[model samples]
Target: MALFLLAFFRRYLLLVLSFLCQVYVLLIRGTPIVVQVMFIYFALPLLANIRIDGLTAAIFTLMINSGAYISEIVRGALQSVPKGLKEAGEAMGLPFYKILRHIIGPVAFRRMIPAMGNQCIISLKDSSLFIVIGVAELTRQGQEIIANNFRSVEIWGAVAVIYLILTGLIALTLKLIEHRMRIV
Candidate 1:
């Protein structure tokens, strides 16, 4: 959702909105995810005078962080759609929206698949950073078990295997989608 909104803003919205989107992308991409998680989990409540739980803060932080990167993925994918396609659509008397819907969108969507897959995996791993704010995610759970049982090697190995399996599944799913959507 954020990716679509930011891409739309950058592509078709007012100049100010486009500029703001760029600034947002720059800020988010430049900062560390850990700091973003900490700031959202700790500093935001103080600044906004609203209370939020660690889980809520963690979700919001990951959303904002991943949205910034995914917006860039979206932008790049859209731009990668060949200029000839748009020109051909115009040559056929198609409107901008129809051109995008029928020609550009599908091609760009296919291009986006791999990068989106990578971003999904990165976001999954990054969620472990929420441990700083006491979100009891998989990594945090593993750490807790290790602390209790003194089985660091086994616990951490299991956590690593779980993450690997999850990421592998994501990659396989995306690859299948990309194969089906191939432009052949």
Candidate 2:
């Protein structure tokens, strides 16, 4: 599965990209998400000859955005894995990769859950910014409906409620994952 490879690749990528992650977070966190969205949607097309649809552009932008934050969460989790555990695993003659796979990763991942959950919620909300690029996500779809009907108050209110429900569902799903992982 793609997810399996993604997880494996992400684990090693976090180690390799730790410093880059720090820079990305520092640079982007100083700027507004709107600015980032605008640059991706507007500036890139001007500089390059390529043209992408709004939805594709949105996905690309959000992946870059989320990756920076997620990498830091991963790096911190990797660092938080006790040095003693690695040493003990070494003492048991486990290979470095085996130690990482069998010992350090599982514990670090459990501790990383809450931070990753927060990142997931952020990514979900950040998807809303795609509307500025004319991506017909929930917000953009709602905006089109409101624009046609001229029911600003009710339509936008419903949009906000829908966002709230979507966020709540994300939180609940993360909680369930945390619970199940904890039980194991």
Candidate 3:
């Protein structure tokens, strides 16, 4: 949704809408994800009069938080595509969608892979923050097991390994994709 909004903003930027997007990005990026989770889990129910479970709140907060950063990544990637290529497409009488699909999209997607991968890893780590709102995330589950068994070193060490494995897999996958998609 944020990507779609960014595409629209890029193509036909309206002043008011542009300002709103900037404000949205600024607000989300300015605050901590934990605070966002707490707001969604605790305050939203009172303010909006809607019941929300911890998992639901966590998911919503992460989506909102990550969307803001991802949109910026996309915006930068799209802008980084050479203007000359776009102009060349225009000279060939390609429509905007055609130019975007056939020319700009591929280049921008290739350039954005590393940044997007980084964002994914960050978002994965950020999920631990949801534990603060009583969501039974990996960290929370680890904490529970430690509380019962009092094996802090072993349990915490296992949790660290799990996180490292997950993040490593994400990086490896992105690197493979980026290598395969490299311009030849």
Winning model by lDDT: 1
What is the model-wide C-alpha lDDT for candidate 2?
0.78
Which one is best on TM-score?
1
Model 3 TM-score relative to the real fold: 0.96
TM-score of each: 0.97, 0.83, 0.96
In candidate 1, how many Å is residue 78 off?
Answer: 0.8
Off by over 4 Å in 3: 7-12
Clashes of each: 0, 0, 0
Candidate with better lDDT, 1 vs 2: 1
Across 1-184, the per-residue lDDT of candidate 1 in tens digits comes to 6679799788778999999999999999999988998888778889999999989989999999999999999989889989999999999999999998899999999999999999999999999989999999999999999989999999999999999999999999999999999967
Which residue pairs does candidate 1 place in steric collision? none
How well does candidate 3 score on lDDT at residue 120? 98
Cα RMSD (Å) per model?
Answer: 1.0, 3.5, 1.3
